[model samples]
Target: MDDPTPEVADQEAPSSGIAKAQPEVGPPLVEMVNVWKRFGQGAGETVALAGVDLAIQPGEFVTLIGPSGCGKSTLFNMIAGLTDTDSDGSVVFKNKPQRDGELLGKVSFMPQKDLLFAWRTVLDNATLALEIEGVPRAKARARAEAMFPEFGLAGFEKHYPHQLSGGMRQRVALMRTFLFERELMLLDEPFGALDALTRAMMQRWLLEIWEKHRRTVLFITHDIDEAIFLGDKVVVMTARPGRIKTVETIDLPRPRGAEVITSPEFIEIKRRLLGIVEEESLKSFASAGAS
Candidate 1:
C-alpha cells in the first residue's frame, strides 16, 4: 500500500479566493467517479468499495451512514488521497491530479478519535498545523487563539487535553481541523465519543457553526439519527465492496433546531433512511454469518 500524501500546513496561505465577477459557482467541489478500492493481494484481498459516483456541491453537507466494514473509511481515504485506487477505476477530487496537493489545505479531515496532544495547551495544539508550515509562532497562535472563543473553547485555551471534558476535547480537536482553513471538511463519527446529552448539544452547535461558515462537508457515521439530523443529503452505501445505494436529500428547512427532529417531515425522512439502512444491515449480517 502506498503512503498517503502529506497534508498542506499553510495556516495563512491566501485562500483560492474566487472573484465576484466569476460568480464563483460552477461545478461541484469534489467528484468521485467510478471509484473502487480493494485491500490486500489475491484471495486475501478485501473489496472495500466499487463503482462509487458522487458529486458534492459547494457548501453541501453530505453524510454517509452504514454498518462497520462498509468501506466508509476506505471511501474517505480515497478522497483524502491517503490511499490510491487502481489507475483504471479511480477517484477524482477537485478536478485535478488526485496525487497533487491542489486539494490539500483546501480540505480538512477530522477522524473518529479526538487525537489531541496530551502535552500541549489547547491553543498550542490547535496551531500546530500552522506552526509546522513555518508560520511565525506569534501569528499562528493569534489566529488560533481567536478561534477557541468562536468554537466555544474560550476558557480552555490554557488547558491540556486531560483537563477538558469529552465534548470539550472534541471541540478543540475540531477547531484544530478548522484552523487549517479548508473549504471542505470530512468528518468521521466526530461526536460518537460524547454522551447522549452532550452529543445532542454538539449536534446543535455544529449546525450553527456550519450555517455561519458554509463549507462543503462530507460526514460519516453509523448513527441513523445523526445522519438525518446533520446532513443536507444522506448518501447510503452497500454492506461490503460498498457501492452507492441511494442519495436522499433532506428536505428539512435550514437552521434546523431540536424541535425539527420531531416534526412530521423530519420523521418521515428519518423513517425512510432507517428503512434503507435496516435492509442493508440485514444483508451485511447475513454475509458475515455465512462466512
Candidate 2:
C-alpha cells in the first residue's frame, strides 16, 4: 500500500491562519479538575496522578507530552471515562460532570497500537466500530468503503493486517477511529510505530484530516517536535503522580507542512518545551531510581 501523501492544497489559506494564542479559551469541551489517581490503598500503592487540571476547547488540537512514568495514559483513561478520578476530583465533558463509564464508546480512542485483527479484512476492521454501534454490516462496510481513498486504502480493502506496512496499518486504524465519529478524539501515539519518513507523512495527513473533519483532538506523544508540530497547545505533565506542569500554546501558521518544523517560530516553541520535558523526564528517572 502506498503511503498517504495527499498534497493538501492551501486553498483556504485565510481560514487556515494559525489560531490566535488564547490558552483555554471559552467553554471547555472537556474539563478535569484536581484529578487524582492511586492504584492501591496500601503502602505499595502507586500515585499515578495528582491535582491535575485540564480544559480543552471545542475543535482544538491539543497534544500532550511528558516523562515515561508521567501518567499520560492514565489521564487518557480517566478522560475516556474507562476509569474515574479519585473521590476529590471531577471529570466533566460537554458541560456535564461524567459519572463512571459514561465516556466509554462516547469519544473515539486510538491507543498506542493499531490493534487490527489479522483475521479481518481492512474494510472489516475499519467498519468494526459502526458494526458494533448497531449499524448493519453491509451499511457499515459501505460507509468505510466510501472513505477508503480518502484514508489511503482504496484498493486494499480485501487485504488483512499482515498484508500491510506499518504506516498502512496505522492509517486503517485511524480510518476506524474517524468512522466512529465522536466529537472528541483521543489519539495515543497513532504513528509511533512508523519510521521517521512515514511518521512525517502520517502527521501531514492527520492535519489535513483534522482540518476537513474539525474534531477536537487530544493526542499524546513523547516527542517534543511531534507535540509542538501537531498541537494548538502542548500540555506537559510533571513526573509520576503527575500534575499539569505547563500548557504552552503553539501560535504558528496552520496548514503546517514539514517546513514549519524548522521555522524560527516552531523552534522557539520546541525550545521552550524541551526545557520542560527534559526537567520532567529527569524527575521521572530520579523518582523511579528512588523506588
Candidate with maximal TM-score: 2
- For model 1, residues 154-261, the per-residue Cα lDDT tens digits are 887888999999999888888878877788899989999889999999999988888988888999998888898899888887787676677777888888889988
True-vs-predicted CA distance for residue 61, candidate 2, Å: 0.4
Residue 125 lDDT in candidate 2: 96
lDDT of 2: 0.85
Q: Tell me how many clashing residue pairs each candidate has.
A: 0, 0
Return the clash pairs for model 2, or none: none
Worst 10 residues of 1 by lDDT: 14-23
Error of 1 at 269 (Å): 0.9
RMSD to truth, every model: 9.6, 10.3
- Superposed by TM-score, candidate 1 places the C-alpha of residue 39 at a distance from the truth, in angstroms, of 1.2
Q: What is candidate 2's CA lDDT for residue 118?
A: 88
lDDT against the true structure, per candidate, is 0.78, 0.85
